[model samples]
Target: MDPSQQKHFAVVDYVIFAVLLAASVAIGLYHALTGGRQRTTREFLMADRSMGCLPVSLSLIASFQSAVAIIGVPAEIYSNGTQYWFLGCAYILGLLIPAHVFIPVLYRLQLSSAYQYLELRFSKPVRVCGTLTFIFQMVIYMGVCVYTPAFALNAVTGFELWAAVLATGLVCTVYTTMGGLKAVIWTDVFQTLVMFAGQLAVIVVGVQQSGGLSEVWRKVQDGDRIAGLDLNPDPTERHTFWTLAVGGVFLMLSLYGVNQAQVQRYLSARSEKEAVRSCYMVFPSLQLALALSCVMGLVMFARYCGEDHHTSFLATSKKDAVVIFFVMDMLQGLPGLPGLFIACLFSAALSTISSALNSLATVTMEDLIKPYFPTMTESRATYLSKALAMSYGLLCLAMSYLTHLMGDSVLQVALKIFGMVGGPILGVFCLGLFFPCANSTGALAGLGTGLAVIFWVGLGSIVTRSSGSTPLPSSCVANRLAGNSTVILQAVYSNVTLSRPSGLKRFYSLSYMWYSGFSCSAVILMGLIVSFLTGPLKEEDVTPGTVYPLMGKLLCFLPEHLKKKLCCVTPLGQTISACQRQPPHQKENNGEAFHRNEELDSCLPEEVSLPLVEQETFV
Candidate 1:
């Protein structure tokens, strides 16, 4: 709390921070002037679907890799040891499935909004439900993303919290409104670099200050900061291999698979191959991001593990602000370093906020608005899209105020929001894409059930303040205390076993990591049950290119005839033969605008209308 402990930025630091915001706006202005002058919904929302793999890949990572991860990951590792690092294991299956499975299905659909697939595969109401669910998820998440950096800075450097929030929101709004998706992607590319540089600077300096890598490693090892694979299978165990790796796959699917933000990037790619490649590219970069944050936590542990300075700040600090406190402490006297890190924090925030605003605009225009006003002029539509982006950006600033009341770690809060809301959204997509028999009624029922269950679990965990398990006390802190070894062991035993919740509380104690997996499973299970009860959809009635043949492939040993009867009535990627037999009147009524376009027939079903945005033929 002392003024002496506060970090003060030099003039160079301010200049660096200013450049980040200024450069972001400049990119927006540049994009606004070129690229059709942001005049069409396609250019504004889909980047004209002309992006290559590189920028799309970087933007994909930046979508969810916000200040929440920047500050939260290190603090998590510091407090809980490196057990969380095992989540990297999830990225393998997480990204691969999206690349090969999700990308192929969604990309071929040529959707402007991811929810459009829901309408094609299910019904219009289902599509609207999915859009609304996504809106709810991102609006809440934008709050955390925008508020995290500002909150952290305020705690350590006396930065004005609300002022920072407004600045971030306004700048992000301006750029997102002006430049649209292109600006959002380009800014993401540039901001991603700044994010890496800032974290690298802190890690490089922290390692040097902590007596270099070897000494730092020795300290962390001695302090028991390096965790081994905890192959615990208990659902209540928070950071076990199963919880993080297994459950984390579902979390990744929720983010990278069905979330509109990432899906928009996948759709914006020049081709399906480019989109898939970008998903693959995300793997290495994501691992690197995780490693950097984890290593920073180790460096922090080495420097301050048992020190009184660590104890003093922690006692007075909000748990989420620990990383900022450490960063400011380490970079205090360095001329431009403090500013660079601040820029890094805001870069992460702005990139995420910008992506969110643009995606929100895209979905609102494509899914919610244009569908109703099919005849809306392109110019008016583009203007409305910009207005939506600006509106959401301002709403995000308001949501940040609500975030101030929450007491959870920023990282946990963000992930919880993803799992609780995103899980159901992912579930609905999975039901529509993989279950040929799933009907609109079933999709609606399953989504409703998944959201209800996940919210109950998520809210209960918060109210009870138990994420099913607590981090074991740090050995560094333990070693410094004067205590009998047996007594300490007994105390830990009591905390782990005796303090465990029971019955309903035990249900609430389910690990937050399992939220997405658990809720997604509920949706699938409920969907199938309801579908069969409501007269399962005939596979022949399903849209082309929507079903992924997951069941058929998984049961490949079955006879071909049996596979068709059990898995699906038609082969994957096959257009409905019935479409060709339909009368001209029927075809027109069903919105079969692409029936004459043979190249599009493979993905475009007879039932769905053309997307409001331009549908270019993929090479």
Candidate 2:
């Protein structure tokens, strides 16, 4: 297992993964055994409404950062540079939009899944449709989140790919299944620290090995790898400001606001205000973390291209493997540093897995299970929630077999799917919030059209193209012009094939930054048109009785009707508004009160009543 032996036979790398995998297993098993019947909906999923801001924020960072950032961001930096990080500013915006807008709305509604907002804004079928789509998206993405790094770990470290994917997937899935949000949040806090330390270790130790930051910068400058702030127009280039900012803004909207994994963290906050604050904190942290990783990528590239550096990237199957390769070969000297670095890799995996599982479970109970099981008691819902989490995790673990085929790593693949799904998803929400003319029928039509467009963009000819028995690597002309490489480096590079092929190759560039943009535009345009043609997507008619949350808050005035609406304080059960009690004066005006009572009754069914937040409908 000597890292010095060959590119993949690194003993230190294996030791790192092995130790972490063991720890994951121990954690998952411990939670399962100790968790017991605490598997109820509120406790298992949302941590019994007892989560604080700081830990929740830390967990939020971990849950969203996942293997995609670990593999994709560094790979992106290796290919591009710090300029690509301009997208982080867009991410900051996405994070802020949700904190100020979406999170508060959801907290007021007190729904489980964001898609439940779809119900409020659209219709029953639309809610179910959105929910199902989310499930499909989560299944594939959770698989990628688990599979990608395991695939990379095995590819570079010479472990069994199947075993690696399974090993990682099983542990993440289990703890998420057992401990729910609490486990994910607590474990994610630890993992986030691990991930940060790991990246810092690579940067510090890699730079030192390559002489110093000065040498690294010199190599980057000499190699012409520093992508200038070329704000000018370039239709042909992949990572431009236009695409990065607009595209990144859309990506953030889908990723941070709409995506269950990212949004779930906010849902677990102590209060709506707390949720908003935690979300606000997430983007800044994400920006800083990504910026640091991008810096580390430069260090890795410097080592690989240095005059003294003998490593050959031409020998590797994927250029994205550079960071991992550097760790295994170039930066192996620091004692225990490798172990910490490896631990960070798991942090990425665990954070993402936790988010996906928790979100999946939330959506399942809120959207799918709640519909037919109207009589589902709080106790019953809780039981169903844990079972659903564990079951879905197992399904994904089985699907990890496909992980070996996804060599592009997690970020690129996730973005590809997210673009197709995320943009439209965000658009659907936008239609709900902004475009009152939008209706369920139009929303449905727009969703289909948007998905179709993203599918065409992301998976070109995957439909018309016949399914092949073998996977051949794709070939593309290496754009030395954009990357600022020498004329000689501009030669075309082809996707290489191992003995195995993915038959599922994408013709698009691996740059995930553009996905959010493509999706958002398509969905936004299509959704608006569809809504305009049909009718108002507004859930309630504009009248004195309506509760206009945003406008009311913005105007610094709560509507008289809304203020008069009865607020009932009840125990956690089938009734909504566990926090407020019904006053005698308010009880007299029972019409508005009855609407919420009906909504609460819907959640309780004939089953046990769980503590739920109040429900309000706005025009």
Q: lDDT per residue, candidate 2, 126-198, as tens digits?
A: 6777778788787887777777676666656666667766667777777777667777787887788778888
Q: Give the residue spans of candidate 2 off by over 4 A.
A: 1-37, 233-236, 306-314, 405-414, 461-512, 537-601, 604-619
Please estimate how well model 2 matches the true structure, expressed as its whole-model Cα lDDT.
Answer: 0.63
Query: For model 1, where is the 10-residue window of minimal lDDT?
Result: 581-590
- Please give the lDDT score for candidate 1: 0.83
**Cα error of candidate 1 at position 389, Å:** 0.4
lDDT by residue for model 1 (294-324), tens: 9999898887866665437665776567788
Worst 10 residues of 2 by lDDT: 581-590
TM-score of each: 0.91, 0.78
How many angstroms is residue 463 displaced in model 2 relative to the true structure, after the best TM-score fit?
9.6
Give me the runs in candidate 1 sitting further than 4 Å from their true place.
405-415, 468-495, 575-619
